[model samples]
Target: MAAGTATTAPTPEPAGRRLLRGKSWLATVPLLLFFLIGFGLPAVAIVTGAFTVSSDAETGAGSFTTANVTDSVQGAYWTALLSSIKLSALTALIGTAVGVPIAQAVLTSRFRMLREAVLTASGVLANFGGLPLAFAFVATLGNAGELTKLFHLTDHGWSLYSFTGLTVAYLYFLVPLMVLTITPALEGLRVQWREAAQNNRATGLQYWRHVALPILFPSLLGGFVLLFGSAFAAYATAAAMVGATVPLISRQIADALSGNVLVGQGNLALALSLDMIIVAVLVMAVYLPLQRRSARWLS
Candidate 1:
């Protein structure tokens, strides 16, 4: 332990490993840049605008304020938020219930073409929302439309503009979205597990109750969160379908941003967007742990 004793130099990591790390980062550059430009900028704009006030009379720089955020949390906007939540939750539930069985059927199908067709259709339908979707439903179910007129359902007090009808219209896309989300989870139910259960003399019900459901539960819950967020943030579909009749948060955001055109209403819209971003963050917070748990079974 003499002061003059020579100390050993630490060994460096292997060249290949360091190069691998560098390459990994290099590979991610495009995606990282896209994330920075696409999502990051809008997020920054939303947060800053949510807190922004008018340009300073002296310096011409935006002043900071929380007034817009405060208003976003108050009466009408709050009500719209509640409406969005209720509608999103209900539709997500319905979509999951309906989509799960369809996914299961497709997953277990013997015919590959049938499965492929259904899956292809599902992919298309999941993305088939917004104004065009609204118009499609209107043309099909409106009072003067083919089925409605032929069946005379309008005389029986059926209205496509009601909350129930809006929920139904939402299902047009949502069910497919759920199917897309859950299909892979259903497929991830390994046949080995089923055969193993059978070897143990387990019934179909017993196997699902004890094993299958446990594995699938986390995935299912994650899908529900995704579905909820998607519906919560939906704008164009609700706007085109019911306009302001449904009082959704997205509708209010649009109104604040474009329709109202009041001074600083853009800030209010940005605050509403921040609220949505918060909800999405909360959803991911819950989903992350559940997804990690799911990986234990899936991996």
Candidate 2:
């Protein structure tokens, strides 16, 4: 060997990398097309509709205007916005409270059979949504439901059509999502920290407060944002449970499009535009904090 340059043969591309690069374009083509068709075109149309209204007799041609937003902001739009925020906040808090404990149990338990059962049950529960899930709960918990009729619980006059019932349905979805998001973080926690704390005679609560909480705060908060987003966007569960009794923002928006809640095409478009704006703002607010926290973790 003449020098360091001559000491070894040059490295070659790994089989995995070569195969991936060679076939990646094939996979990307379908995905790119899907994104363009499914997301890009609809988004452009919504933006256009949000800015304009149909022309009246005074106007010769269809016109563009900003009044769609201004008009909505002045009307029931504000009420819907406030209601959505309140519901999302409540759902996020309740979901996080229930989910954190379930996630902790799932991640920390050394029982393999129990862990597998939890994973399987969670997977099934995660997909339980829409009207069917609502009716399932209704049939079991409602006044006419089996549980009610079988035990004469109907005398108690329980109903799954109240705001409280809607909250329960929302939690049914929210808790699973939180568990899914937090479990990975829980598992990723290094065992040594807990062991060290235990060796030092730290109580369970102290270990959680002083050792685990700081490490998991970012993930927990991110999971909270996810739960809030789910609750905010959900329509089916709310509609099935509350009907027209509770005027949730989503149900209202759906009614607008079908001319059942608010009248006029312009109003429907305006409501949808308002909803889009609210979602955009909420997503930005949640994601920015989450990103900053993640950056701090990396640092």
The Cα local distance difference test for each model comes to 0.87, 0.75
Question: Which numbered prediction scores highest in TM-score against the true structure?
Answer: 1
lDDT of 1 at 88: 90
Among the numbered candidates, top lDDT falls to 1
Kindly list the per-residue Cα lDDT of model 2 for residues 1-299, writing each as its tens digit: 45555555789989999999989889788899999999778777777776777776466355687776675555576576667778787888899999989988877688989888877777677778898888888888776778778888657655677766777777887888788878877776777888999999999899999977877777788888878877787888778767877656776677767877556655446546556566757666866776576545434
List, residue by residue over 154-181, the lDDT tens digit for candidate 1.
9998778878878988899899999999
Candidate 2 global lDDT: 0.75
- TM-score of each prediction: 0.89, 0.80
- Model 1 Cα shift for residue 120 (angstroms): 1.0
